[model samples]
Target chain A: MSNQSLVDAEWALSHLDDAKVVFIEVDEDTEAYAGNHIKNAIALNWKTDLQDPIRRDFVNKEQFEALLSAKGVSNDDTVVLYGGNNNWFAAYAFWYFKLYGHSDVRLLDGGRKKWELDGRELVSDVPSRAATKYVAKDQDLSIRSFREDVLKAIGTQNLVDVRSPDEYAGRLLAPAHLPQEAARIGGHIPTAANIPWSKAANEDGSFKSIDELKALYEGAGVDLNKDTIAYCRIGERSAHSWFVLHELLGVKNVSNYDGSWTEYGSLVGVPVAVGDEPGTA
Target chain B: MSGCGAVVGGVSLDNVDITNQAVIQGVISSGNAPASVGYARLLDRNDEFVAEVPISKQGEFRFFTVAGDWTIVALIPGANSRTPVQATIGKILDVDIAVIK
Candidate 1:
């Protein structure tokens, strides 16, 4: 099935009890889910659930299958994800699921923030369902990028740094208030463009209009025809941008550099440019 | 404020001037304590809440500040009291928070 990238709160509400639909809440703060979350929603921890504890990368395929199976998520189920931080962790989960070849995942547009702001129902009660075996395909590398790929794309201008201007300029490594998405050094990959990830959303945490989105990216010289790699401090924010570009805008060759600035900025001998602008080589 | 109006990290660029600031990045973990939910509060030297964000499952957190020393306290869910962690920032600082349970 061709996955619909975004679903509204009302749609999610109506489908909450549907057998074919499963609701998952991905949050950085693992305790947020336990406090009060959408009824029947299972929580996915952005850190422990998504990553391999022994490695710096994601969990392997067996672990992925087991996690889904334990959560009662079968291969054919349509997974709906929503969470805190404007769905930052949700988008990251969306990307992670897609990486493991799940084809029917969708994001709850505006996430938990909008749901709470709109006075939607939230329950502390958890749901338990009989576990189902989930068969996962191999990881899809096409939607993910590595540091080497970013290095090769230097000067091509297709790499987009979705961090703030100060972080992009080397004036700051990250926002003083947002240290969770920080790196060791400030600046951006050479030849990349600075298009802050938040531009894709509206004041209410919902996405901007389609025309507005097209104009926003086009204004930044991000042509949809060519391959594009979007990155932020780590990867969650950039996954939001990736969802906008690849899913909403239907751009063909967009990938999230999940390693992002955390990896690119810490590497030795990798060229980086500092200034308000993304200078070319 | 004089640049093309762009929204950055949920704030409008027209309002924020980041010409000079320091960044502090770190992960907050309790050595053997169970993972807790909630946010970490960034405090000034006088112990005021300057800013806060939810702590990650891996205990990751970040903060941006002017050039100076600062302190933070974990606001984990179901925990009695959180010990304060400290850091100093010039341009950038990496200080991991290991909460004393």
Candidate 2:
């Protein structure tokens, strides 16, 4: 069950020309793939292609179907996703694929970072596949959570704020590079554990060993047995954590709060806890 | 909704005016060549990760942060290095990191 959702560079390299497999790159720097990418890989902009144009939510089922169809991704193809920033956006897309009930989807371990670091060949040639009549299922809501679920889980479930410590402590509203006006207030949900998503990744951008991952969360006071919800300012980073907890560790009940702090912190009358401590109820 | 993080990979700030911003910017290189494929990470005083961005094709990276002591770590193929700098408001600090393979 553990290695079922991940593939290494070697496996991916050997299958570069496999007709039954598709490689998709979803990068944080949206432009990364354009510079160079794995042979025959297609690019999916996490913002434009995946998200709904007017709504704050993801694309509807029909839209997803059209997207994959245009990308020539068949329902039976094995989709392997990779990206920059330790596969942050890639994992987010992986969650989206799972939400739409796509089977046989997996992540490229370490993603673009590892691919480049290993001195692997990345070609600028883009390949085109004939469009397929893609079909998508209703969103699997079990893996996704809304602000209400977050509020309800407060002090009851294992709520994990997978942002930088500064963000969790209210020292900064958002990451240092981005604008600081994402939320009306700054701080994390009460009784939430602050475990930055970067902890699950190595300096080289690959995920740590399974034993290391288990110890990292358990050492951070995240009860593995409890139903857990992971959140970041937006959802991508938390999706990485959700992948770790749910897919990698085989946790029975884990969800990613896509609305995250922007929705939760902006909600009026809801309690917000500042400082380094995970405040009590 | 607005995007959450900056667009990375071969980004150029040549036209960006950082006149009044506290910025930590640099070019990453190994030996005599630019380390074009990699990521640059900004770490706080406590050595905790703050943010990361993919380096430009020209091996450039930048971070707009509060004026303070910070460390910049470059993760590239066959090489990695960290450099410390003290940033000040209204001024740009350039710290070029040379990774040894």
The candidate scoring highest on TM-score is 2
Itemize residue pairs with steric clashes in candidate 2: B10-B56, B10-B57
In candidate 1, what are the lDDT values of residues A1-281, reduced to their tens digit? 12378899778989999988999998866667887899899998888788888767899999999999998999999999998776778988998999999979999987876676566788999999679999898999999999988888887639988876656777555544543233377789988888877677753467888888899999987777778999987788889899888888888699999888878888999888889777776
The TM-score measured for candidate 1 stands at: 0.75
Computed on C-alpha atoms, the DockQ of candidate 2 is 0.52
Give the docking tier of candidate 1.
incorrect
| Whole-model alpha-carbon lDDT for candidate 2 | 0.86
TM-score of 2: 0.94
Instruction: For every candidate, give the share of true A-B contacts it also has.
Output: 0.17, 0.51
Candidate 2 lDDT over B31-89, as tens digits, reads 88888778888898898888887787778887776678889989887778899989886
Off by over 4 Å in 1: A1-3, A179-183, B1-63, B67-101
* lDDT of model 1 at position A132: 91
